[model samples]
Target: PAVVNKIAAGEVIERPASVIKELLENSLDALSTRIDVDIEEGGTELIRIADDGEGIPADELPLAVTSHATSKLRQADDLFCVQTMGFRGEALASISEVSHFKIRSRTAEDHVGSELAVTCGERSDIRPIGCAPGTQIEIRQLFCNTPVRRKFLKRASTEFGYISEQFTRIALACPRMQLSLTHNGKSVHRLPATNELTERLTLFYGSQTVEQLIPIEAEHGGVRLWGYVGHPSLNKSTRKSQYLFLNGRYIQDRSLQHALNEAYRGLLMTGRHPVAFLFLEMPSDQIDVNVHPTKSEVRFRDQQFLFRLLLSTLRTKFLQSD
Candidate 1:
């Protein structure tokens, strides 16, 4: 039986932030070095993502916004050895299901690309159009199909703040991507591609935040951890600022998060959280990247070793600063 792709989109694309995350990952997967994001009224009105990478072909344009369609993977084994940031292929479809979507894309080989317009998972128009060799996606009236979801939304200001933080985290992780974001027609962030991670960190966080960073590096059993962490005195009022990435992908593993906090045991005041931005790199086979639908959570085969490694590396950083 052929399942309805429309119903599935409702589960995958729930909010504006979710749409933003998926589009950003697609840009990264396309090896795009530059990505521009523009949003209006916390994405309730408009959200647009433009990337200068290999765009979809005229024929693939329809499938690109169809459920369960992906250019990232083909087989079950590919899931285990994942390298690209996204594989579900549900983002575009999901976003299209709940909002007004228009995709203008062109491939290098074709003189003319195609434009696709979809409303709530229904195709209203698909036509050939001349455009640059890249992708531009515009979404409007997010979550319009699901009135219940809209009811639960926070204030526009609060939602925009969350979106800003998400983009900043992604920018910091992928310093090589020239990222720009705007809110309500005003520019809020513009990060040019740079080889130096420190500069990106400084730009993402202010100069004041960078002043508190301490560099840390550790290698054990072929795996290496490298990055910066905030000083004990610079503990944040909340844990939102704390971040960790594994091979340039942001992740949240309970084991890893606990190991980090345990390393800062006595250094942190009660209820305060220390900030971190560390990258853990190892053999791809050693980690299971398919644990989460969003690809933000990973499960390691040797969980104990990773936990210990994270704790020891962080502890050494704190000790050296003493």
Candidate 2:
């Protein structure tokens, strides 16, 4: 069982950034208004996430680290309509299987919080303590028990870069949530809660980048698309700046990428890519989020219709701007 868990951990927790992504999703699922992330040595040495959200009860803390124990799913039917980010309940369990994990949480109704510590899937300690009305999780020596997985990690800088990008993506998706990130005791990003997407974009990209963005808003066949796309004059050599969100969740879709590229067919150079931050809103049943374990990729029910809608809407917007 231990070996099986370690193997599954490798699948979900591929790298330090993967751990960060899962934790951030959990925090968001908890309805956290503010999240603070701190990492050291690219999260290999330590990763701590604190959130101002509803905390776990003293008794549920243990089950939280148990495999397949999830609060997100009530029945088999709920699988098709998964609105929460961390549904499988594998993240905490998988993380605890390979790292020194500790969770301290207190609900508003509780006078004191409880802390549970687990090392390599073994319960080391559990105690009641005073804490704020939220959850704080601390992980140290990630993948210590799985040397093979640890060996595959890139350099600290490279790993940290992935972590930072993940942080920015989550922050962008939830613009109303305050987020803070620190690396090696140095502050990397400190974003305040804002209702405007452009304001959040300015914080993530910069004022100069925001100035070059064209606002896009269109609706077709019960789907609404709204976001900012870079002006024709503002092209990038790489597609790193392109970000697409579906129903407030970050996703990567080849068809959507092709639609975006087609919209900019004549404006951009052959090798250059247009920067965009596009958001798609459609009914939950129209798409499936369970296609990928990481939930980064989704499957749409009507691919051709979506492609046409996106291409036509974006093309019209670009033509109008021109």
Task: Give the Cα lDDT of each candidate.
Answer: 0.82, 0.88
Judging by TM-score against the true structure, name the best candidate: 2
Please report how far candidate 1 places residue 253 from its true position, in Å: 1.7
- Regions of candidate 2 where Cα sits further than 4 Å from its true position: 74-83
Candidate 2 minimal-lDDT segment of 10 residues? 74-83
Query: What C-alpha lDDT does candidate 1 achieve relative to the native structure?
Result: 0.82
Candidate 1 lowest-lDDT run of ten: 74-83
Instruction: For candidate 2, write residues 151-256 as lDDT tens digits.
Output: 8999998999999989988988889999999999999999999999899898877899899999888888788988899998899999889999887778899999
Candidate 1, position 19, lDDT: 81
lDDT of each residue in 219-253, candidate 1, tens digit only? 99888988888999988889877788777778788
